[model samples]
Target: TRMRPLMRGGAQERGRRAGTENVPGIAGFGAAALEARSNLEARTAHFLQLRSRLEDGLDEIENVKIIAREAPRAPHISSFIVKGVRAESLALNLDLKGFAVGTGSACASGALEPSHVLGAMGYSASEAKSALRVSFGVQNTEAEVDEFLAALREMTNRNGTLSGRSTSHFTL
Candidate 1:
């Protein structure tokens, strides 16, 4: 019987395994870390501003609650529950309208179960299942955030429960 290394290259692991050093990956990671460190304050302020805008807009919508509103959280991400709509339904509708959104933890991606994090926070199973996560990035602009808020407001208002099928009429 013969066994092959999972990753084959010139030499790796003191010649015990075969793989090449991930030079490019290491370099890219270092570069990203340097960039993030260089403008940490400015980036943080920008993210906070965007998140504030998103939260304010969300506050205007009925039946939507921002999770952990009083808790300190990362500035770039906002998690919320939009009652009467499943997270999957809203995420899929947003995707079809050219917007990318997340439902729960990436590890739980595509799982029909509710978010354990939200459940731990005392949210009901239905509330946890209705959670949506939106993250702001350095490349995102104020206009983009406004657009997303508008789209979300419209979808939630017009689609109601959106339990059966999505009828997203949002554009751009």
Candidate 2:
């Protein structure tokens, strides 16, 4: 239908994209990459540890589906599905409670049309719609993870499920 360069301006990016070279941004990115690469082992271990704690906490929640728990993936992302709740609503609630989370892939257009990632992995449409993508960072602490879990429990349990019904999140 229509096509244009991602960046338009000068002959930057080896004539692929357009736009003048962002020297400072490029330097920052390169520095960050170097730092991350230097700490790859520690970073992976830290994220995996955080992920384990999060998964353990989620395990006690009712009907929470841990997506691809045994599959190969980066240690930082923890994708899951909540039972009887829409992921978008859940993400909003979590945000209100001070946690930033992402919902469906098609949320760009203000629509929560379910995640293609989940669908490709054989999750049902409902499960896909209920998916949340939670990512951990090396700078995050165990206490932060605990705090988020507590907030999650408070949000999910306090307001019930996302089907506009009251649920006792305590036992969940």
Candidate 3:
């Protein structure tokens, strides 16, 4: 493979390595940046409201624990652990039920070890491994958050043990 300069000139980009410009990617990135900057305040408020609702519902579940509940955190993301359930099994079950959830940081997806971030937060290895993350976006609504809350409550209650048998079919 050969490196092609994006601009065929005497010196392009400080005469360093270069390649063909990704026009489409650059355009999409620009569009996204513009959109994000357009209504930033409104988007932040919406995400905060949704996260509040989610946290309230999660609080009613006896076995669920929200990480960093007292610390200031991002309004769009929530991390929690179900006392006796494995995060991977719960995530898969939710996926089958049409909800996408993440078990760990994107950079460490599929890794067997627990998250280092969670460990730094003073969580035990098992608790860190059980962490599940949910994110709220501009496209989400209160109804969707409620539905997700209900589904999570049901799944956690249904299993109710460390047996890790929550992989069974979960309807709704």
User: After superposition, which runs of candidate 1 have C-alpha atoms over 4 Å from their true positions?
Assistant: 1-6, 9-13, 17-28, 105-107, 158-172
Which order, best to worst by TM-score?
1, 3, 2
lDDT of model 3, residue 152: 77
Candidate 2's C-alpha runs over 4 A off are: 1-31, 105-111, 158-172
Number of clashes recorded per candidate:
0, 2, 0
Q: Kindly list the per-residue Cα lDDT of model 2 for residues 76-145, writing each as its tens digit.
A: 8887788778777777766766678776542332454666666787988888877777888767888888
TM-scores, all candidates, are 0.81, 0.73, 0.78
Q: Cα RMSD (Å) per model?
A: 4.0, 5.7, 4.7
Candidate 1: count the clashes: 0
Question: Model 1: per-residue lDDT, tens digit, 133-164?
Answer: 88878888889889898778767764446533
Question: Which candidate has the highest TM-score of all?
Answer: 1
Better of 2 and 3 by TM-score: 3
Please provide the root mean square deviation of candidate 3 (C-alpha atoms, Å).
4.7
Report the poorest 10 consecutive residues by lDDT, candidate 3. 163-172
Model 1, residue 60: distance off in Å is: 0.1
Q: What's model 2's lDDT at 54? A: 91
